[model samples]
Each structure stands twice: as structure tokens, then as C-alpha cells.
Target chain A: MTAIHTGELVDRIGEAVLADPAVVRLDGGPFQTIATYLPGRRVVGVTAADRITVSVVLRLDQPIPAVAAALRERVRRVAGDLPIDVHVNDLESKEEPV
Target chain B: MVTTNSQNDLRDAVPAARQSPAPARLADENGQGKTTIASNVVQKIAGMAAREVSGVHAMGGGMSRAFGAIKERIPGAGTSSTAGVSVEVGEKQAAIDLDMIVEYGASIADLARAVRRNVITAVERMTGLEVIEVNISVEDVHLPDDNGGDEAPEKSRVE
Candidate 1:
């Protein structure tokens, strides 16, 4: 098995999350000023350890709990059984009602 | 020593590969090597299955449905049947996640159960893969006035 790098793993987790329609982007929220800034490669909230943590901004239309659960499953698809921590820092207001 | 073999047996009892189901291969006794079913095929199957259920107004969230609408308006862009359906196909099983807008007055619980049943039956019969789960998210409710009542009712000037 090819070894997975932390940066690459972070990238995958980011991609999996951003690809979901419910997830809008990664926002620092209250952690904005405190987070370290990496110019070229920035997965702002992702931290490497035994598992991964993903914090993001999500659209408010979809249910938050469901979106978080889906994100966990999506991350697992790439990271294997590595546990994930998902934080919803902010919510984008719903633009239109169905 | 014997316990280790038993541990392997336990592992085999619930195959780890089932967790992330991949393309399945059926090996026949004949010289033919194998028959593999791609995951995309399963995704499409599940998408179609979900669409077959009644009370499903649409298949995607706000953004994707908006994009789908735009794509449909374009000259040659056809509407996607797989807008809100996502699947992870494992070797012996598959898991599906769907985002949907249900018509108002429909029982969300009953609708979800129906959709799940349809999806599972369709996928299993077609691919011979066990459907581990069908997770449905009711993103929004499509009310009767949603289509035509773009403008809010004018406020009474004399009230």
C-alpha cells in the first residue's frame, strides 16, 4: 500500500467536503485570527494526528446533522477508518425556499 | 496459535472490503476471467430508482438543482438524472446517500421508507450487491406556491 501523506490526506478530506453541495466553504469563524496562515497549501482547519478534523461553513438549507454525517462518511471513503472531527463554524443563509 | 486462526476466521465473517465496496467480480468456472460492475453504474441505478418513487419533487439540494436548471436551459445541456444521488459501492455491498425535496403534504417518513425500499430492491436485483444502507436527507419541501408566487403579497397600504 502506498503511504498517504498528511498534506495529501488533508487535501482529500477538503475535496470530499467541498464537493458536497451542502458544504459551502471553509471558514475560520471565531478561529479566524488564531489560525496559522499557509500561503500555497492551506487546509486551514485540518490537523493531523491519529485522525483528522474538518471544520467548515455549510449552507443552511440542508439539515446540519445530516450534512455532518455525510461529510464523515465521505472523508472515511478517502482516509479509511481514521476518525474525523467535523465542526460547523458558520452557516450560509438559504437563498430560496423550495 | 489456534486463536490467531480463529481471529482471521472472525475477520472473514464480516469482510473488511465490504466497508468500502468496490467493483464486484463474479468468477465463473468457465475460462472467462470475471464480470465486473462499475460503481458509477450502481450510482446511476440508484438515482433512477429514487426518481421512481412518488412525492419526490426533485433530487438535489438548492445549489445543484439551480445548476441543473441552468444546465437544462442551455441549448444542448440535458438534465442530469443523477443530480442528488451518491453511492459508495463495495465488493459485496453498496451504500447510497440522496438529497431530495419532497412535495408538501407528503409524509416525510413514509416517503423516505418508500424511496429506500425502491432503491434497495432496484440495486440488489440489478447488481446482485447487498445494499448496506440508503440514507435520505429531506433537504426542502416543495410547496404549491413555490413555483409561481415569486413575488410576496403586496402589503395593504391602508392597514
Candidate 2:
């Protein structure tokens, strides 16, 4: 029941994050910079039907690919068959000096 | 905690120091004592629900995340975000209050309705959490897509 649903929920979010190109975009997305917990923290192992979704504020100037790849790999390692969607809310580009 | 008899009452009152209280099961899978999966679970569940619509920006509004972090510093919060998302253990049901920012060009009523339907369908099918209400609050609308960077769009989504 609830336990199962929660697992599915985690998987879906992961998928959603992985699917979004913008999420992978380095300059603006939070993939590498953001602190991931839970499903994100469980990246050491993989499971069937794994998907995850994440959100973060990232430096907009960087490319999003690294974040996406790292995230996907992490989710795959921990929860296999997982889909992750990571959305960026606030982005600060490195082009502009902090 | 309830005890049926005097012996049981003694056991309950005694607070068995020897038995390290079972790790608080925030959300267990296969009774393996898995608590590290609670926040990500709720966050992702809500994320799946929120993005189906055209306008949603992300989960955890400034206020909620801020307060959630604040609550984290305090000892009482067993888990973050769990307080917000409600659940029925046996029924495997859950509900969430969604906050979103609608983009320009989409109809508020139409977008909200579409979001509601999608959220319910996705959450129920994927998580088995019976969403009681996909209540939506359109927080803000950004500059129109045509308005160009930094400039306010000709028309506002909310107005």
C-alpha cells in the first residue's frame, strides 16, 4: 500500500526529471548544485520501475547536461526503470559575477 | 499506548530501555526499516502531479519550503513534507495542496482543470494515493513569451 505508492511516486519523479531537456541544461538548472534527499540519496542501488522528479535553484550560466546525467545515473543505480523529472525554479547564471 | 493487563501496564510504563525503540518507520518498504525515502517520495509525487499542466513552475513555494526548513531545525518533525501530505496507511491514500505559477497564453480555468484531472489520474495510477483534492492556487504569471527577456509581456496571465 502506502509504502508501495511512495516508491512509485519516487520513481515517477525521477523519470520526469530525466525526461526534461531544460532540467539537464547546465547553465540554469540545479542538478549538480542541489542537495538531493530520499530517492535522490538512494542512488547506490537500482530497482525495477524506478522514476524520480526533482526541483532546484541552479546557476543559470552552466550547462544542464551534467546534472541530468548524474541524476539519471544515480536514480538508475538506486531505483531502476525509474523516470525522473527535474525542474529548475530559480537560475543564476555564472556569466554574471556573483 | 494501551495495555490490557497490569503486567502489560508495567511493561509499558517501564519504558524498556533495553529495547532500542524501533527506528521510527517514516515510510517502510518490506518492513526493512526504510525511512530515508519519505521527503523525496512526497516531493516527487507532487512534482509528477504539478507538471502535467502547462503553467506549473515547481513544487515547494517560498513559504512552504522556508517553513519546512525551519521545522527541520526543530526536533519534533519526524520527517519534512510528511506533515503536509496526508496518507491512510491501509488504504494507501494521500492528498496534496498544489501551488503553481501559470504561464501567459493559457486559460486559467482551462489550465487549472487540465492540471487537476492529470494530477488525480497520475497520482492515483502511479502512487495509489487517493488524492482527495487537487486544489490549485495560481501564484504568479511571468512576462508573456513574446514580451522578450526582462520586459513585461503585453498581457499578463493572471490579469
Per-residue alpha-carbon lDDT of candidate 1 for residues B1-159, written as tens digits (9 for 90 to 100):
012223345556766875344543232112211222445556666777888898998899887788877876764343466678777876567899999999899999999999999999887765566899999998899997897563577689996
List, residue by residue over A1-98, the lDDT tens digit for candidate 2.
Answer: 24545556545544544454433322212234332235445421222222344554344333333443455555545455434443333333345322
lDDT of 1 at A72: 75
Give Cα distance to truth, residue A67, candidate 2, Å: 27
Worst 10 contiguous positions by lDDT, candidate 2 chain B: B28-37
DockQ of each: 0.02, 0.03
Give the TM-score of chain A, superposed on the true chain A, for all candidates in the order listed. Answer: 0.78, 0.40
Segments of candidate 1 deviating more than 4 angstroms: A1-98, B1-31, B67-79, B149-159
Candidate 1 residue lDDT tens string, A1-98:
22346667777777888899987786544535312234465567555456456767666445444566677778879878755556565444456211
Candidates' lDDT values, in order? 0.66, 0.46
Scored by Cα lDDT, where does model 1 land? 0.66
lDDT (C-alpha) at residue B53 in model 2 = 60
lDDT of 1 at A97: 18
